[model samples]
Target: MGRDLSGTIRSFLIILALSTCCFTTAPPDLQARVEQLEKYYVEIKEHFEAKIIDLETKVVRLEAKVEKQDSLLADLKKGHKPLKENVDINQHCRQNATLRTCHEIHVANPSYPSGMYWIDPDGQGIGDPPIHVYCEMEAEQSDVKGTTSILHDSESQMDIGNCTEPGCYSRPIKYYASDRQIEALIQLSTYCHQNIMYHCRKTPLNFNGIAYAWWNDKDGERHKFSNRSTTCDQLAYTEGYDLQYVVDNVSLPITRIHFSNPFKGFGQHQVSRLRCRGKAKTEAMPRSCEDLWRMGHNLNGIYSVKGAKQMETVFCQFDKRPNEQDFQKRIGYQDIKTRPVYFSGEGRRLFMEKLIPIPFDHDVVNIGGAMDSHSGVFTAPSTGTYFFSFTGLTGFKGGVVITEFTFLSSRGVEEKIMKHSTISFSKLTTFNPITVQSTLRLQAGDKVWINLDFRNDATFRFVDNTIFSGWLLEEEI
Candidate 1:
């Protein structure tokens, strides 16, 4: 029994040893497993951290994109503001108001000669209204410019102010005062005067009357007076004058008056007196008292006429003034019949028959004119349609003539006129003279002169006589 108990003890000790070894090995394996788990946990934490960083980056990008879009929308909202309400008001006023009608009634008068209505449409009567409007608009616009900033701040106040209400139409809104309307009317009147009246001055007269006229009654007789003329003889005798006298009295100077000799009964003294008084001898015949009384009253019977009527007949005539044809044919005659001066020069003489220069590239030859050394330019004193003529004998070769002319202009801006022409010799002594004609539009301030340029070094000889003839012309009706 002792042996058996000893064996059991040995078995128990072996099992305990085995159990201790298995326990130590299990702990080492478990520790290794725990280390592997720790490594896996560290990898998971790093992955989670990386994922979180990526998500944060994506969120930041989206936020910036949203912010940019939001800013763009805000800017778009700010750019499109409404126009001012005053613009509407002004448009309405302009549309409703008849600026022209107001002007005609307020500023124009139908009767007075100096009144606005009588002003010619093409005359200076127009442009007054537009100028006034421009001035007022300019001033008001300047004020608007200065106050624009304050206006922007009070944008809400720019509303039309309940004008759309139903009762506002009948009830006069106190906004547009009577004084404002009066001022507007005055402005419109002035505008019409300036624009219509002033611009009308440029128009031509189509009808035949004084620009303005009026009728007046004096001594129970009605008379018409013209603004342009003050001739008492022009008074039409519609009902008063017994005999109308048609006189041959022109505005021009009278050279002479002729009358035919009277009949044998008329005395020389009566004929001479009739001639001096611009009456025909037939019209001035002396009559006996009996004959003169017979036309007006009943004569007493029985008594014969004491003197027979001295019958006379005379031809009324006047000297014929030089016609336009005569004046045109005469050369070298001053416009006022003054003597013409001759010029001696080395080049061909150039004459500007008209104040205006001929068109460019015109053949001007043998034109006669004297180049005045004393005066730089030719002086045309008389103001009329002048024929400026010059004759050139073709002795000069390779010579250029420059006619430097100036015309005084009452209206236009150009002050100087220039013309150029070349002179060429045909043979040793023979040359063709060029003629240039130009209708110069001249005013009172224009003067014409000639110059010479020689190219061949040869001395040019030209006649110096220049003709400036002008005839007085009536103003265009």
Candidate 2:
């Protein structure tokens, strides 16, 4: 037991020694110890606070950068939007052989023997060359009256075919020709292609029937004639063969040619003079008289006959009549002027009040009482400079009452005041006229009103009535 007690005492002594050592190392004054602890805490807090402040600044900068990046991305998206592809003939010509060939062919045959040719660099060729042909026929005025025969041949001396029977003789003979007939012979020789078909059942005593008749088959067909049948002696007929062919073949652009020689001299109206300039593919070639006439109408501006001076008067007047739908686009009747006024009063006694509610259309209302009063208001339908005029009179003492005249903007905001007019009792019963002029910067849908304040005791009668007239002088800047 004694040994155990000694061991416990020794352990307690060791613990006491350790406690004494800790107490001796600690600061003695509370204020000093607190100050050291506070210093450490402040240093640690400042370090953490600095780090947080830097992080916050970085966050703000990052946000701004993100916003800028987003704006750039939106701009890039807008800039990358696709654009429309414009048609480029140069590119198409380089890529398409038909276009190239058509250009080459046009260069080779610039002008036809008897027509006009307009070569548009951007226009597409109708089709392959020599595939289509145009045949023009005409009946000449001749004194002889035998069967008019036309023979086709590969050569000038060679005979291909001719009209049989009564020899197709007539005062005004009609004619027909085929593209195959022309193509077959035109390919061989120009002389062989001279033959054209003409047939007429009736034989006339005089050859003064049809001065001209002809036909041609191109991408489209054409026909022309000269009639000396009426007083005007103008060229006239029913639906022409050229017009019919053009209407039937909507796909092809057709042209017509007309020839008239007021002077019937052989030298004046030679075949060369009758020939027209023509365009096929991109080439200009000499065209027949009929083909030239057809194309002349298709071309812009005026055209005249070659050679004969009097025949040059023959020109085409393009149709310019307006269609029904075009006429309907116009609204309101013209040549009518309307003046409207407003009055304030009950039943028959109502007198002209301030001009408020200017009637767009004229409307009549009966006044009720002897001392009735009313107002008038005029609203401008559009923005423009305007002139205003009004006329009226007073018939009784204080009868003619003065009213406030004002103009209002589209927002119902008053813009200007018109002159205030007052009349004596004696003058009230008399007729008077008022006029005012003012410059207004009125937006569309603005309004102008006249406010009339009449006394109950005053009895008045208006002469020539009160009316408002506004005329647009000019557009306001």
Candidate 3:
């Protein structure tokens, strides 16, 4: 027992010694210091800190310079203007302190032929100075790194098919008539690979930043220009076999082309035998590459049911087999949408302080059953811009005062679409008619209805001639 106790006590003492050895005690605060050295060390620390601050400032300035260079690179992709022949290529055009760089190769080549461009039908130093004619073409691309000849199509381009004529896959031709007015001729060959002729027309559809071009299709119904993003330029819309030419398969034809802006003398009158031009190729090619094909409208006898026919050409650009693959993609590319709803009221009395739903039950073409004719409410069929128009005729013979308000209903609150205010016809009460039309962007499943000014205790009745109609204008991509 004595020996066991002795060993246990010795082990306890050994453990205590090991614990003490593992961790050394913290040192006591030093009081002995040379006042001169202490001050010198502090100054040295401050000097190093100042150097660090200076380095950080330089880094910030360097980063800003890099960002400015990046912005200049981005502008190069948009497009470029002329620079002095002797000036270094680095100098860029500046507007309001913003840089405009030259066009980037990738940006220029991708969106090639689909833009509205101005061209001169007659080359420079020709008969007339330079009549700026609007032209359009579908942009095609090739690995064509060097110059392209107007007379030839590159074999290196992707194999589309057999060329019906020459100039199937050609490079974009751009000529500068002064730096300001440059002309571009895009080569979008037809499916049969023939140069396309265009029957140009002036369309006066400029409203609310939206332009429209209308034409009669083979179906005989006047169709609106389908390409929405471009101003009226040159459209390669002529297709189908010409009574003059015989061929293999019928090619797809463009019904019409529309522009967003109005040109002074374009599309207003039908120009008989309108003249157009193409670019020149080698030095041997004439500088003035004038085309001898004159096209005009042949609209003397053919008429619409309403006897409305514009002066249009018979077949400006003759084609036996149309390139449906291309035309179908460029024109009429958007889904032919017909989410149309129309409502009419036959002198129906409207009650005050109540939602007035016009039972415009005339089913013209309702795709998604959005317009409930009996309920007088139109639920949105899709998310897009829609056009709505309403016309009403009423007389204040009852000496009743009323205000009408139209509202669009959704999850949040009703938004006022449009309203008409007619004073009490106390002295003169006749069947006065009021009409209102509006284009609205609606979300999917949104609802629309009318109300007879509930807050104003208004009441009114619409005449038999009253009408409310709307159609989907466009769908968001």
Candidate 4:
């Protein structure tokens, strides 16, 4: 449409001059031809000017149409909104229907990552949240600030509702996760709480130890070795000659584990699964090691639980003596408290049922001997196997009553040794006898004692014939 106005005018004038020559009125010479051509050009100029104006008008209309199309294309690029895709709320689960399997989320910012916890757990905060959808934005994206309540496809939606807007991963979140996340994260999210259209990235966890004592806590929290070794209830187990050790959460980078006790097991049948377990040092019972809950061991292997205190039986009564290491250790009993003394049943005093700490200076046996009569406690002079025997006489007022206990105190822990026996006072005139015998291993610094528990209103006393004794059978175990 770009017309050359001057060129068109010259062509028209040349054609008119040729036609005038045919009429034979104008001269063919330079002066005469020029004068005639100039006159014709002046007349055609008016028409050319009018034709140029018409072309210019057409150009303006085309430009307007192009602008309109450019605007329309921009609208098309924005696409549609409020996406609708069906999703199953129960897509993932392991133990419970609502709880979903998930990994812990890690990010550079202290605040949660994009799309974290957006899906609701429906009050079941049992698993790890796959993403940080529910987190707030610490700083508004300055580029889109206050532009609209509905954040754009590339913006962050801090508020609620189906704000499934696409967003970049460049910004920071407003705050930190809840306290539970700070302690440890288990499952990431429940199936029902997952986002329908959004996919959040999961953080990677470092690989841990080997299978021998592999336990897994979602965040590896249980793997940490604690400061205190035993729980309150563990302190009461004073039976069997078992070797024990405490394993704390480790601080190594490798995910593999390498730990085992000397306890022997064979063909899975005689073996016990060494499970990861824990408890507050002050608590009575240890809880399963949930931190490393998923870690497992070989079927019949002798293994130890990581981040747990273990009491394993390395030897039974018939086993050989302790190794050379144990031979060097001794818990010297200060005196030879062995005895074959006897008490008389002929003259017995009334003794009511009650707990009595032994070693009372008046108990008849060596008052100030190696055994402390005041507290009824005896310190293990050496690490050795000991045989303890107890005999008691009953008064006529007594019924059947025989329940006693032994206590061992060591390393700030007090444990109870279980003992049971039966004594009947069928013949009121004759003294009833009760006896209990036990063999155990004692460590140096350990304090052992017997507890006399009386039953019924009937009374009983150590007859002049009664006797209590103990001696080491072997040392080092």
lDDT of 2 by residue, 46-149 (tens): 55544544454455445434644554465469895322111232234334522211223233332211111112211133211221111121114221111111
Off by over 4 Å in 2: 1-351, 358-378, 426-430, 455-457, 461-463
Candidate 3 C-alpha error for residue 204, in Å: 79
lDDT of 4 by residue, 403-465 (tens): 465655578677667666555555454466767677778886677665556555445444333
TM-score of 3: 0.27
Q: lDDT of candidate 1?
A: 0.28
Per-residue lDDT over 5-84 for candidate 3, one digit per residue giving the tens place of the 0 to 100 score: 46655755565564445334524222322343345445554555445444544554454345445444554675753222
Output the worst ten-in-a-row residue range by lDDT, candidate 3. Answer: 93-102
Model 1, residue 228: distance off in Å is 54
- TM-score of predicted structure 2: 0.23
TM-score for candidate 1:
0.19
Q: Using TM-score, give the best candidate's number.
A: 3
Better of 2 and 4 by TM-score: 4
User: Per-residue alpha-carbon lDDT of model 1 for 226-287, expressed as tens digits?
Assistant: 23222212223222211111111121011111111111111000000000011112212223
Clash count per candidate: 41, 74, 14, 49
Each model's lDDT comes to: 0.28, 0.33, 0.36, 0.35
- How many Å off is the CA of 127 in candidate 2? 40
At residue 408, candidate 3 shows an lDDT of 61
Error of 1 at 359 (Å): 25
For each candidate in turn, the TM-score is 0.19, 0.23, 0.27, 0.25
